[model samples]
Target: MNSEIIITKDFIEIGKLIKKIGLITTGGAIKVFLKNNIVKINNVTPQGRSTKVYPDDIIWINDDVYVVKREK
Candidate 1:
């Protein structure tokens, strides 16, 4: 099953989402993680850490899948 990440705002940065999900602890780590791992947003590789992710977007990091959902 895919994991869900709840967002309160209209969008969240790819780097922030990585950090929020506990994949990395520091902002700089996002760079390293992105470099070593492939992350796909909506089945497309993100431009970078600043890539905007909105609600209902599907994020894939390696074999793990994450679905973005708006907070109710």
Candidate 2:
């Protein structure tokens, strides 16, 4: 599945984005999920949950794709 997230801020953390989009239920699960799953931002694997995702960034989690866009 593909999704798009509109953000008003300059950037959003990878962990928060994952949860915000309903990928995971709890905040604590982010670490485990990132460890077990393949997640990339703009075609590069993020360093960790603290990775900043800015607008126009593309996130890939397994086969799903998520695009980040700025709020207009």
Candidate 3:
């Protein structure tokens, strides 16, 4: 499913975004999930959890595509 996330700030980390978006229950789960899954940001797979997700960026996790929107 396709989803849109409205961010009130500049950017959010990939891991943090995952948790914030309710994709995962906790930050601890991100490590395990990332190890077995892929998080494609702007059509590119991130190499680490530190990848910065900014507004207007498209992120793909599993079968879901989440579009990030900025408020400012």
The models' CA-based lDDT, in order, is 0.95, 0.94, 0.88
Question: What are the per-residue Cα lDDT tens digits for candidate 1 across 1-72?
Answer: 489999999999999999999999998899889989989999999888999999999999999999999998
Predicted structure 2: lDDT = 0.94
When 1 and 3 are scored with TM-score, the better candidate is 1
Residues forming the 10-long window of minimal summed lDDT in candidate 1: 26-35
Candidate 2, poorest ten consecutive residues by summed lDDT: 19-28
TM-score winner among the candidates? Answer: 1
| Per-residue C-alpha lDDT of model 2 across residues 1-72, encoded as one tens digit per residue | 888899989999999999998989988899999999999999999998989999999999999999999999
User: lDDT: which candidate is best?
Assistant: 1
After superposing candidate 3, which stretches have Cα over 4 Å from the reference? none
Instruction: Tell me each candidate's TM-score.
Output: 0.96, 0.94, 0.88
Write candidate 3's Cα lDDT for 1-72 as tens digits. Answer: 998988888998899999988878988788887888878999998877778999999999988999999875
Better of 1 and 2 by lDDT: 1
Cα RMSD, each candidate:
0.8, 0.8, 1.2
lDDT of model 2, residue 49? 90
